[model samples]
Target: MVSLTSPAEAERRPYGPRHRWVVLAVGVGAQGSFAAMFSGIPVTGITMRADYHLSTGALGLVLSCLGLGVAASDIVWGLLTDRYGDRRVLLTGLTATGALLALMAAAVTPGDGAGVVLLAICLAIAGALGGSVNGASGRAIMTWFAEGERGLAMSIRQTAIPAGGAVGVALLPWLAQASGFRAVYAVPAALCLAAAAATWRWLHEPAPAATATASATASATASTTATASAGATAGAKEAAPDATAGASPDIRQKSPLRRWDVWRLALAGGLLTVPQFAVLSFTAIFLHDVKGEGAALASVTVLIAQIGGGAARIWTGRRTDRGGDRRTYLRGIGALAGIVMAAAAVLTDAPTPLTVAALALGGLLANSWHGVAYTEIAAMSGPARAGTALGLLGTALFAVGFLTPLLIPVVIAHASWTAVWAIAAAACLLAIPLAPAAIRAR
Candidate 1:
């Protein structure tokens, strides 16, 4: 039997020099795969709506259906990652996702409500399988990276979302026009398969120190020190590597989901991401319907938003590392997100450049918090239960991911697009006042 590292053992063995980076790279690529496939409907919303004769609200339901599936499956995937490790979970998920995407391509029929429903079901399955990527990839990164670099590392991993969104927004329209929406699905499927192969070859669990090595290390314990100390997202953990370095052989029972701090972070995170998802879901439609931009051009603005969001993630991620109050930083960003989203929503009738500016800033600020949030979870929970905590957080956050698209259209129909964005802005601002535990969990 291939003995995997217990969580304690994972703590003892320092991550390999180059292997960690390779893991991060492969993991980010897989992240892109997840984002691309789930966001496919919205990215190609224009063509899909026309083909299927979907009303705005109906389209929202179809797009959000996939995220609903992701929300449902997120925790399950997290648990699997904790038990089976990131490699097995991610590889299996991505590979299955590829096959599902192909089935979606072959199965969906244009202009049929039943066809849309069928496509939605396929997407939901694909989303669930793809949901495997987030928590597992995060746990792997937490295990391999020390504290000093974790924010930046997680930031890069987080980029997979916006980066993939950008690719879908920029390319999928052309692909849809050229070959049909089926071709668009084919791209993600191919990418998933390729990512699966890369993951198999490159990803490895942090090796557990054998008994002999542990014994030897005890004698020379003073000679080594970790750059990152032990901690949890909301829980206050001491910085002693020796304290829990040889934890129980089974670490699955130490779940972080029960902690209030974890739940707080999860809830706040879910709410804060609403505007970002809203923008991603509606920008193409809004611009096409309101801004008079063609499909490709309208997509250009959202594509730029993704680019800006990625850059902001990298910047803020690096900044979040030198932290006095990670939770406060999160809070501040949440408030800022609300302000920007509301402004962007109202910018519909403003000058084109100004409208684009609001969207860009909204994208940058609204979506940039993942690295910081994930870092806090890993720091607080340690590698032992990071998967579960991250997974729990993902479940909460993506629930909004599932709902925002579905709800946005209702607001648009009852009020206006401005009202839709204003509501998203309020969601972020509302999260600000309910303070979670600070950098150190009590």
Candidate 2:
């Protein structure tokens, strides 16, 4: 996989291997916030219901607001990172989000309209800023790693989302059980603040060095032009393409929409997301409503899924490193997910252990494509515009995710619980063709 990297990309990519782990750590930290922010939906539903006297629909509205925030802010954060840099945006966003999460914790209480509205606003901010993680972290990994190794690295980074979410699910409930729902928000707040500090201390904008070098090179070229013009050589009067001007054009032309590869990545990302978000958003509901499970049991089941998804993420990354085709793996995972989801739909009457285990395995296979898909995008786009490409991919996937709650309820309303699972299975099936197209584009 010889990467057709621009000189700017080549210069920006870390030559030494030491920076890879640092980039991975940054990715993990950024992604961990995503899990924390979104985890509120499952644990805080009862609290919100009690506090705000929210109906089921009202609770759904509150949760959906977070998705709306992410959808609205993803592109903005992406552009900011591309233009200014990731370090400042990431650090500031994380810190602000952490404070807001804590504030939201205090504000969301019984009979508190102002509090609820404030909480919603804060959640929106968190979602929007947290959305930047994909772009910033993906860009870092892509810029720091070589093509052959990027798939594995990017996969590992992608795992942080599920892994972080799983931790949140496990921790928040136990905390809420012992203390209150406030603990759920409080824990993430602390973690987010810590991540913000860590990012500030350790993160560096790798491209600044490249920019400086380009600037110096431009200055030297200008000096040469001045000298040539002073000599008044008619042969040298032709305006050659200045290296600095060429570099500036490269930056301007880095839009992901202009690239065929980016569109394929986004489409494949959307296909993969349809199922993953469905499970993430609704697993607790399925356990509670269909399987006659309690909140505790449902939360536990969701936690199991998260664990499977997280472990599978790291494993998938390692497997990709060992020469697995990402497209093949994604389609295979999707197919397996569809089969398992179908079984889950039809076998809803199965024993508790069997049903739970089936869903856990389903989660594992369904979410395993996280690393591979992003890795492919990073590889396909090369390093220079990795952030832009990943930003577009995240936008498409998150946009699909925004529909999960709405779409799934429609299935559950018209049909039996089995029909809901069947719908998810169908969604996974839709990903089959896209997987090969995704790999071919890479």
* Residue 269 error, candidate 1, Å: 0.6
**Best candidate per TM-score, number?**
1
Q: Encode model 2's per-residue lDDT on 260-379: one tens digit a residue.
A: 656765776676666666666666667766676756765676677676777787887665544455656777888888898888777777888787777666766777788877776655
Superposed model 1: Cα runs more than 4 Å off: 1-15, 109-114, 209-254, 435-437, 440-442
Instruction: Itemize residue pairs with steric clashes in candidate 1.
Output: 231-379, 231-380, 232-379, 232-380, 232-381, 233-380, 234-441, 235-441, 236-441
TM-score of 1: 0.85
- By summed lDDT, the worst window of 10 consecutive residues in model 1 runs over 234-243
**Residue range 119-175, candidate 1, lDDT tens digits:** 778777878888999899999887776554567789999988889878877777788
Model 2 alpha-carbon miss at residue 390, Å: 1.1
